[model samples]
Target: MTSQDLLLRILNKLFLGLAAAGIFFGVMGRSRAAERPNIVLILADDLGYGDVSCYGATKVQTPNIDKVAESGLRFLDAHSSSATCTPSRYALLTGEYPWRKKGTGILPGDANLIIKPGSTTLPEMLRKGGYKTGAVGKWHLGLGDGEIDWNTEIKPGPLEIGFDYSFIMPATADRVPCVFVENHRVVDLDAKDPIQVSFKEKVGSDPTGQEHPELLKMRPSHGHDMTIVNGISRIGYMSGGKSARWVDEELAQTLTKQAVGFIEKNKDGPFFLYFATHDIHVPRVPNARFAGKSGMGPRGDVILQFDWTVGEIVKTLRQLKLEDNTILIVTSDNGPVVDDGYQDQAREKLNGHRPAGPLRGGKYSAFEGGTRVPFILSWPGHVKSGVSDALICQIDFLASFAQLTGCRLNQADGPDSLNILPAFVGDSKMGRDYVVEHAFVLALRKGNQKFIEPGKGPKFSKPTATETGIDPDGLFYDLTDDIGETNNLSIQVSEKAKQYQAELEKLRKEGRSRP
Candidate 1:
């Protein structure tokens, strides 16, 4: 037979196999068997590429996180849009780059809702497809208008932004208010004392870490010396709501319990749970149960606790028989930061363990460590278990999920999100050709080549103690060859660097990365 006839026969057989598989799974129909899968997006706070055992952290054992990787599709090239929690969370939810919108930075606890009303969100898209959506833990996206009364019902918040039920931390654990917000009210708050929160000025007569360092269990390394709550000082000032204040150690347990409860209550049908954990962030106070578990101090202990949280959710899913039908994603908001603020012995007890692994820079950096995080997507009996180098981002969840559930969205809805559902489910090996990383500076990554534009800023942020990746001269590195970014190939490959710079400019000017 001729080569043309052989190619035609091979294509015919491939089509037949796909048709058979589609018929068996009802992939071409919207039948009950084809019901939209339940989604559980577990966002870990400050989890780095090397934080999980599966990702090569020898000091920390993350057996549960490894389970997800063992049974799911793990992506080596997955990244968050930015290197900070607030900005990355905004980009993930809004499907727009945080830099495009003003006020999308590290927010004070009292800051207003940065996500505007009527904005289409990931939860909103899922809700449109008849899925009940719930958000629990670490909602640092701000709440209410600019001047919100903590005593009153905080409206125009998560509920208005597509979450059917929300129990969130309002902000970071290190930030104040330092209480859980269930639905629209503060959980266990008393009306007699009322809750008062302030970032600029002192709220009440509560003793601060600055005034009484002896009272603090964990001393602030930098600016986390405001109001004392549960023996730990936070970034902002809070006076009343004693009953509502969350114990620093109990945070992981509380958030995990909330997530399990949300899953149990919404187990009747399709549901979406955004379980954002504050574990491994600053004030690394792990529960007594997890103390000394890692022998690497609070930082490592909290990582173990975070793993436990993942185990609990997975256990719940298995008990309810939701594992097969549930789509669980385990990923981080950004890279790691050892000594963010508190004196937690994260740096001292590191014992030569690299949190960012082979990647240079962490947290607030334009390098791979800042945004490239461990991403795992698991749906038992549906998605094949394997490792993929496909370049995927948390921002693509909005558009990819919309297509997965048959929910239609216009380009206006998710200007930066792309429908890479095939890659997500392990059906395709290829994903986006390039993606942008935002930090103090902007950088573009196309395949193995990375180009960082020139920007003016202090090369190092003294507070976070991170390299800001800012320089007057543009930077370029072939990440495939030099993962540490030690070599400057911009001068050697001037033409390629210029091309990437132009691509970055065009992407910025167009205001959207997806076509």
Candidate 2:
């Protein structure tokens, strides 16, 4: 053979080898992507550790939520990043403590979007990892840039923050703009009657609860007395968008349907559904089917309704044959509150129910009840069926999920999120080295020792009638012995308290907790 012929043959062989290797790696990449499971994170509003039946509530049975615990691992020591809704949600999505940011506090309905655009969020990270992301129901994390024109397309919202599809209540049910926002537009909105919302002053001639108490079906116990919509007063003044306004009674069903639709639409493979429910919140209105069923009035009835919503989602997953490939996580934004704002007989009707279970405080508290919520993780054949005592926090979801999808996170991504995937799937009992709980005051938890930094504030909240968990002198407790946080061990364990105080200051000043 000629020398040119031999050279041509060698070049041809090299090209073929390179092409074969590329095809092999491409197939492997596809296989790994296929193995990634669908994550459905159902976050309940104001649900406490003792609210669900599996978590030891006897007043109201949460059979659907209990089923999740029975199917997989139930975490005994899981907490949200904060005691309030907006802050906890911010932490869960951003993977950074909400305290690290300003203006992350409970936002007004008309407030601007708090989650900055172009930031690394849990859904965004999953989307980059080849997953379809959707958010349904309660979105208290504000919307738009300052004043929002409800008639026009809302920008810098859930869509801009990572969700491919979004069906959200602009704020809370108790807040103004009492309507459902599908994607960027208000659902069922009429262009002629644009929505105008104002937290500052009364916007329209709409009769408020304070002006016309007789018009209300559910009276406000406190400050939820602004605009009257569907015979219920909300926190802010909203006029117009009459057709777009949501009915308190049908909220659970409507949100559940949207969640089910999202799951069905994305049944192809990998998807992330952040289903934040509005049930059991203020204006406690349960559908006719669940009304008077709990025998504990509005609060109890709504809890039952919330359970039904969970059942519907689980049923959809099963019917679609997606249960086996789905990782279902059921948790709450914070602790519970019997009387948030509505005089719905939540406090009066509780015969023997303990909303916070054995925990000390609830809602806007620094105690265990505020941040420690019921956390259940179920993935059929993937996560083993058992109970775990691992100290995991919802803020860790971003990093843990990144690990699951084999996605490499940058140094700036999930700054406070530690990859506790092993503990999440029941593979390990140890989770985080420490977790900081946020409320009126910041509390640090290392192992079983909890330290609350000294602060100046009302010891208790008069509006919600909840303990603020604040003390002029710092408080410390060994949770292994005092789960309710009744005893303060600051004096006894002075050295330990000092160490935790120093660590908390260090973590706060350093900006990121993840090492």
Candidate 3:
């Protein structure tokens, strides 16, 4: 009963303690592995590269969005896959190039949905991985099938493409049928006032923008004038859905409230929110409260609205105390352009504000500013605050989030999305080897060198503006040497151009997202 008995007893106790520890940690390990971060993707519509304070917009202040950048990683070199609205949104949601889907350019509000139903999408992937998904604000990805009947429920819209809930604009704010479509139905549509839409001939008497310039509050400098809505000429024709029409000034508040409500409701469960904003876009009708705040007209006023909306979201996160468990990705659909279609004097009253920061080209061009825009990420305890030059794309979110949740996207779907969790964590310095840049045709970006193809330049129409690289030559420039993309290096570096050309072809052949 002396030393031998005491030693045996001590050894037995130690073995039992070790067994319990193993079981406890094993369960904890599985739980951590199953732990998924709440994902928030805030997409600013038609916002220029330099529109936000983080991106260097001196004309306006966006302190709230800047706070997200300060709290996390600010990506300086982020490029949207396409230069236009529809294509870029499509590419971002599906992880595929816009050109892959024919007839899928900048869609008219009247046109039937472009995205095929029952396909794999970003929000859909998250839903499959045990996440509640919703998209609040603009949905330019098209809706319904061929010959959609307005009186009936709309099909194959955002909800059909993987969103569990959606409240979005059918197309652009400047377009007709200017109503909010929630889930499968257009909101507030009275049965008596059936909606009818057409991109071509007018269906009823609504005073065409061309005929009734007297009623116009916002006149178009280009092709925007068509139908009159809320005293503004739009791009298409719509006769009904009168009650469903959205108030342009109140759009920011509506979207912000919806986003905040969703976050508060889902605090207990991991959720994914695709917050798409209609600020700084064409038909820049900021609320009366935010009017003249930027001293730049409706364009600048809308920027203020956007900033305040962002502040509300950040405040909601702090209030919920879910900052550490959430991963917020803030990026725009494409670069900025002042005129777009409206004559807001964005070009004249521009003052010293640089909407594209140091990049060149804007919105619908193959140049740097056209595709490259501001990108920032925030995850309180998980991500440290700093600026990163790591080249990333909107397409990569599919693979990144999928990797985080132990979900895998079939190569047929997310072909171009590379899982950059390490890069997101700020440990790795590499992203994609080469990313294809699209304005209309195609361009190639590899490392610091960018190669643009010649002919049929992106701006086929005047609405694209002159800033859109229409020079009758292939554009090439080293970003390190020319951040504004002023100098063309097509002749100076012929070999580098050829290499990028090959890269572009390879990626194109492999193809992009489907749906």
Please provide TM-scores, in order, for all candidate models, with all chains considered together: 0.95, 0.93, 0.91
- The alpha-carbon deviation from the true structure for residue 113 of candidate 3, after best TM-score superposition, in angstroms, is 2.8
Instruction: Kindly list the per-residue Cα lDDT of model 1 for residues 365-440, writing each as its tens digit.
Output: 9989999998999998888899999988899999888767878787688789887777788777878878899999
Query: What does candidate 3 score on TM?
Result: 0.91
Model 1 local distance difference test score: 0.89
lDDT of candidates 1 onward, in order: 0.89, 0.90, 0.80
Clashes (backbone N, CA, C under 3 Å), per candidate, total: 0, 0, 3
Give per-residue CA lDDT, model 3, range 142-227, as digits (tens): 78878767677888788777888888888878887788888888888899988888888887888878999989988888877888
Task: Write down the TM-score for model 2.
Answer: 0.93
Q: Which prediction has more favorable lDDT, 1 or 3?
A: 1
Which 10 consecutive residues of model 3 have the lowest summed lDDT? 24-33
Clashing residue pairs for model 1: none
Query: Judged by lDDT, which candidate is best?
Result: 2
Q: Order of all candidates by lDDT, from best down to worst?
A: 2, 1, 3
Estimate the TM-score for candidate 1.
0.95
Residues 189-244 of candidate 2: C-alpha lDDT, one tens digit per residue? 98888889899999978999999999999999899998999999999999999999
Error of 1 at 508 (Å): 1.9
